[model samples]
Target: MAELARIQPSLWFDSDAREAMEYYVSVFPNSHIGSITEYPADSDEKHLSGMAGKILNGQFTLNGVDFVCIDGGPYFTFTEAISFVVLAKDQAELDDYWAKLSHVPEAEQCGWCKDRFGLSWQIIPENMGDLTRTPEQLQVVLGQKKIVIAELEAAGAGI
Candidate 1:
């Protein structure tokens, strides 16, 4: 568990920084976009492309975590190694999230899904940690990869 909030999680984007921010704000509660600064045509780098103030710097609070989104272009990309999970307290919460977040059908699964922007997220039960740390039951299944949640819990429980 985190003691105090200070550092912000950074997200690099190839484009659509503003659009992504707006969609994100709508997805999670108590979240908003801060400031957005774009590049200026005056500079050699600016003439290439990008909004003059599209959102050079902005802040988004999603499910309590402060995440910063950036449009760094081909310079960087997101991978499954990093993901944001929402600990839903009930079936309703989980179902609602699964329905809304999985708007992109290509990204749906057993409680795990991804956003329209290819950002992966897991919508799970709030007390799921208790099940995973059991050290008795075993289950797992990664993303579209080798393993994922079912295996993780079983492993943690030492099944």
Candidate 2:
């Protein structure tokens, strides 16, 4: 076994950790599912009765970033406070991710969107800083649900 990542984001799910992990791996390149530990069937804990056979801990990599997830009962959920940022190389990549991940239209704002599983993601260009260097360019980005690299560049250049 390889050494564990220094910092891995752990996600808690009601009972869909495996599904979520698989979906993520399919969406990203260089990604794969790792070891999955299921809850013991003979556990004495009544509280975990429904969790038997479910994923107690599942590891996966999304574009090389390590993440762990569990099928723990729904005591919590994802929120906008914490979101994954995808620095896309260009508009095509950004649009591809946005098309696949953006499920909640109400949550869309400034390149941030919520996936079907309620996970928030910021799909922005790799050169976002350079594109939004000017106030007009920043405003252009802020007003758009998905970031348009060309628009930002035009705004930055006063076009």
Q: Top lDDT: which candidate number?
A: 2
Where's the lowest-lDDT run of ten residues in candidate 2? 42-51
lDDT of 2: 0.91
Instruction: Report the lDDT of model 2 for residue 41.
Output: 82
lDDT of 1 at 77: 73
> Candidate 2 lDDT, tens digit per residue, 26-61?
899999998899998857687787678899989999
Clashes per model (N, Cα, C within 3 A)? 24, 0
Q: Using TM-score, give the best candidate's number.
A: 2
Per-prediction CA RMSD (Å) = 5.4, 3.0
User: Candidate 1 overall Cα lDDT vs. reference?
Assistant: 0.66
